[model samples]
Target: MSAVLISVAELQELLDTAGSRVRLLDVRWLLGDPDGPQHYLDGHIPGAVFVDLETELADPPSAAKGRHPLPDLAHLQKCARSWGVSDGDTVVAYDANGGMAAARAWWLLRWGGVADVRILDGGLPAWEKAGGKIVSGEEPDPEPGTVVLTPGHMPTVDADGAGGWQGLLLDARAGERYRGEVEPIDPRAGHIPGAVSAPTAENLTDTGHFKPIEELRARFAGLGSGPVAVYCGSGVTAAHQIAALATVGIDATLYPGSWSQWSNDPKRPAATGTEPA
Candidate 1:
């Protein structure tokens, strides 16, 4: 079976036979929030290892880049080796925030040419709600598989590239952020020129669970795209948009640096007080 997505029940059934080959990752982190690892240390799914989003998944912040830049491929390969993730292993990842962080792992794994990856549906909360097993302790070790890194999967475009590309650039921030009306995280208020606003929050209901697949299809269909490229302040929330699009068979790519990096360079054009062009 293709490594798409698996529910708690489906994972439970698979755990009996493929437990050793299945590498479970708990990717939980929050922007400007320091309590993520502490929460993970308190409790997590049994046999799951914690993957820090900022340190493990992304490169350090730079002057001309976003807060959560994409990590170096060589560094990530080492991390995969440490986690016992060989090229042949089936990796599963989950996060507390409805696959936001987990999607990062999924994207990174795919970018590294590891196709046998799946995100746990509904994340940790759903796992706990389903009465799945939990354990608190140091992460266990697995036999490392061959680590193979690939390129060209990281689909990113600069301001000029975005303007010239045929794909629709979907901004996944709140309307206020996208409009450059409010400045909460980044110093700049505007977004990239010609980018459409498609907030990730719209993908979820009031309860924070993902909306139905049909609803997601309707939402993405409204974008009218040749190809879809999703972005956010620092590429985190944008993953939510990608996940939503994937549910609807949209298969959108992510602009990893996103608005944070775009706004850093004064030369790049930024649009304020305007809708997408």
Candidate 2:
């Protein structure tokens, strides 16, 4: 619903200028990592607030709703407020693992009706490479935000919608997972029927920055002609897939329940191997 990414230099400029009112969020998370907050405390962009993706950004894990189900709207609003986000604030989110985890914050803010939010392109390493400063310990409590939030600013597809999707339904997990060769967390192996493997890792370059816009366009070209939707193991990296698509001016719907929820169901048939079922 908003611009997908911001350069480290651009973000620095904003932070340097007086009254930029930039609300920086460090969404430090990895699939199996429980040390996100510890990582943030060890070193982070000065004044950047830490947001726990597993708690603040998502509802409790459930077999029916998925591991990282979208949090309740009111709770999300409270979380954003605690992050010191005021109305009209420019929010920048980042993480060490590319923008893989950071994109979750980027997507949630945009979906929460905040118009000016973006992922820090290339994430933490990008800023460090540019000689950006880092600080240890928690930041001072910012003035609590007065921002209000509404939902549905972004498009989504539920399990039924994903199954009946008319256009591309991309499985954004690793190719091996998509092929049913390996599923690390979910209950099942393989992808939803009619889904295509489009691993989120390919969306980035070796340095973890998003690939060039034209490259992204070429990567997704000819996959489908109608609307587009994406889902990952849970729903976390799916937002990264959407962010990559946004760079190429493509809008994508998210299946928040994603494979985690889909696989939990006994009735939803799954497809395996290299081809769409």
Candidate 3:
């Protein structure tokens, strides 16, 4: 089993084990859904606490800093403790959209130096399919935790570094977006120069769970000889890319600012029509 992922079956077993200390976080969010709380309130994995993607998982949006800048470490620690996370506790985060949004929590927690964070593969629907019962309404506030935090557990790239990145710079958006065919959000269309199109969607199967480890490894094999970094619309799906890569024993950096930050700057060059310009 990959350290970065847990199957629905595994999660159910963990929850079933008496006296097991597992923290489940229901991170049910989408790009444009501001009503994540409402959806979570309707029903969620029993004992799962809701985490707001826009507020808790990211700092405020800014023209210079991008839509979802990394939250302050102290603030993040406060949020984690609010979720009842303590040191050495195994945390599982999941969402309705495959593991796309949930990967943010997994990445952020790992970046904050939590050792045992994992994404519940296939997410909420998978849990329900596995006959896992759900509970509605707000969960009780947990006792404050004493988990300390430190950053830099994972690597990252800035706009300047991404422009001149020595290793492979992967654009994790859809292929059409990479080709500048369409862009639903952000300042401009297209992607950074010299970036290869490695859509994060390909990392998953039709069932929404991640592809097998061998398949993932083959999909990414020979893309880079040195370090690799990934970015997407606002750096959300890029974390999904990073999580997929981690399953295959490949460490990758994230351009947290992503295209949202890069396209805002007039001087930063944007390329269209793909071909890894």
Candidate 4:
């Protein structure tokens, strides 16, 4: 299998090479920013198509479905085709902040059965630092593609599955969030019982790139050895955790509903404090 991560220089070479047919998706989004389009217009990689995370990548949010419900497979297929994806073509996704947002596309495409999807390591800054040029405004519409999207390429756990998971269940939120000290967005603060506190931020270095493979392997090693599943405030950052686990040869499942869905329910148990419970 192709690596889930790709470097800036490697991407540049692929884009420069003739007949490479790599699709570049510029997914510029902030949690509360309504200006994703403006961010893309300010500057983006040349020949890159901008994708709307809210509308394209996820379905309408409901308290019951979590903040970022997975998009319907048919809708995602249409969106992927609109972005000019094709069968046998490589897809690369990137965002301004590390690979946080872009990891959504990487995981979605891989889950949807795109064989060769990757995230631009270090994201936009890495591209700039590598001497890759940026282009303002959008490029012309790309030729529609015929890539078929098939789900089940990746593993996932629902709320019930998470609660009773026999293996490792990782909570990819911050310590404060997991401890119920702060509940910024979700209905409730705490985390699902039996889930370990493994914040997604630690997956990256200060430079915003993922840590070395050996380091990542060692980091997860201390967490325990078993089938792994990861969740976050919503489902978004959990994908980042899954990508990091992939780099270390560990296959982790995603909890799409995550805490957003889990907390909304009064029946399900919530655990707070430093311990995993």
Clash pairs (backbone) in predicted model 2: none
TM-score of each prediction: 0.93, 0.98, 0.97, 0.98
Error of 3 at 192 (Å): 0.6
Better of 2 and 4 by lDDT: 2
Tens-place lDDT digits, model 2, residues 107-157: 998999999889998899999999999999989988899899999999999
lDDT of 1 by residue, 9-85 (tens): 88888788888888888898777777878878889998888888888889999757688888998989888877778
Each candidate's lDDT (Cα)? 0.80, 0.92, 0.90, 0.91
Please state the error at residue 32 of candidate 3 in Å: 1.6
Tens digits of per-residue lDDT for model 4 on 199-277?
9999999878999999899999999878999999889999999999999899999999899999999999999998888
Q: Lowest lDDT 10-mer window, candidate 1?
A: 154-163
Candidate scoring better on lDDT of 1 and 2: 2
What number of clashing residue pairs does each candidate have, in the order they appear? 1, 0, 0, 0
Measured on C-alpha atoms, candidate 2 has an lDDT of 0.92
TM-score of 3: 0.97
Question: Which ranking of candidates, highest lDDT first?
Answer: 2, 4, 3, 1
Distance from true location, Cα of 197 in model 2, Å: 0.6
